[model samples]
Target: MNPTEFLDGGTVTVSDETYTVYKTEHPESAAFATIQDENETTVVAEAGTVSGENVIESEPGWKRLTFEMVLPFELVGFLAAVATALADEDISIFAISAYSTDHVLVKEEDVPVATKKLEALGCAVER
Candidate 1:
């Protein structure tokens, strides 16, 4: 496989738990969904603190992974390649795919090693 370029780099740590969908305005729409744990669920009116600037609810118990990539967009097995690269370093990832690109969230503990692995794979690491 040819090595790819990553303009921006980010890594977030999440837990082993599953995330359930919360309030979705369109109800049946929105390519990306917001989720939280059952017990940790609650609604908030303030928008500035959370992403998308909407009143939303979530469980902070989990972690967040954020990546910034310039998009003309290429789906070209990016996730699988990243997964394999992370796996080679014994790091696990819980990934989410958005319209523009992919986000891979791993344990914060594994971040340094993951960075090294990604760098080794010949992708730019934005530290």
Candidate 2:
């Protein structure tokens, strides 16, 4: 999917909360995002809520860009399109896709650059 096709959502909001990734069991909180397997579970939660052992990685200072666009489940390459745009600018990102939308996380320092890249691609970005 190309960026232009998803521009109907029009606004992408950058979250201010700092999130961290934890290596643990199924997270009990709905506030965070998680990916789980037989061997491990990766939980991305607000920094303040994470505590205990097996902390895989802490993304302490990152910003999440929420794509408000209501994407069809059948749509393809949307994340790739966004990632490619950011990667071209040397902005690394961690992405999440939910039932209604897609979100991308970038280092706090790279938020501005990420925003610019997205905007240039026709995505209206809001911080």
Going through the candidates in order, what is the number of backbone clashes in each? 0, 1
- Kindly report which residue stretches of model 1 are placed more than 4 angstroms away from their true locations once superposed: 1-65, 70-74
Superposition error at 126 for model 1 (Å): 3.0
TM-score of candidate 2 against the unseen true structure: 0.87
lDDT of 2 by residue, 1-127 (tens): 5546786446899987877656764563734688887887778777768666555555576678899888887778888888888899999888888998998888889988888888887778886
The stretch of ten residues in a row with the least summed lDDT in candidate 2 is 22-31
lDDT of all predictions, in order shown? 0.50, 0.78
The TM-score measured for candidate 1 stands at 0.50
Best by lDDT: 2
Among these predictions, the greatest TM-score belongs to 2
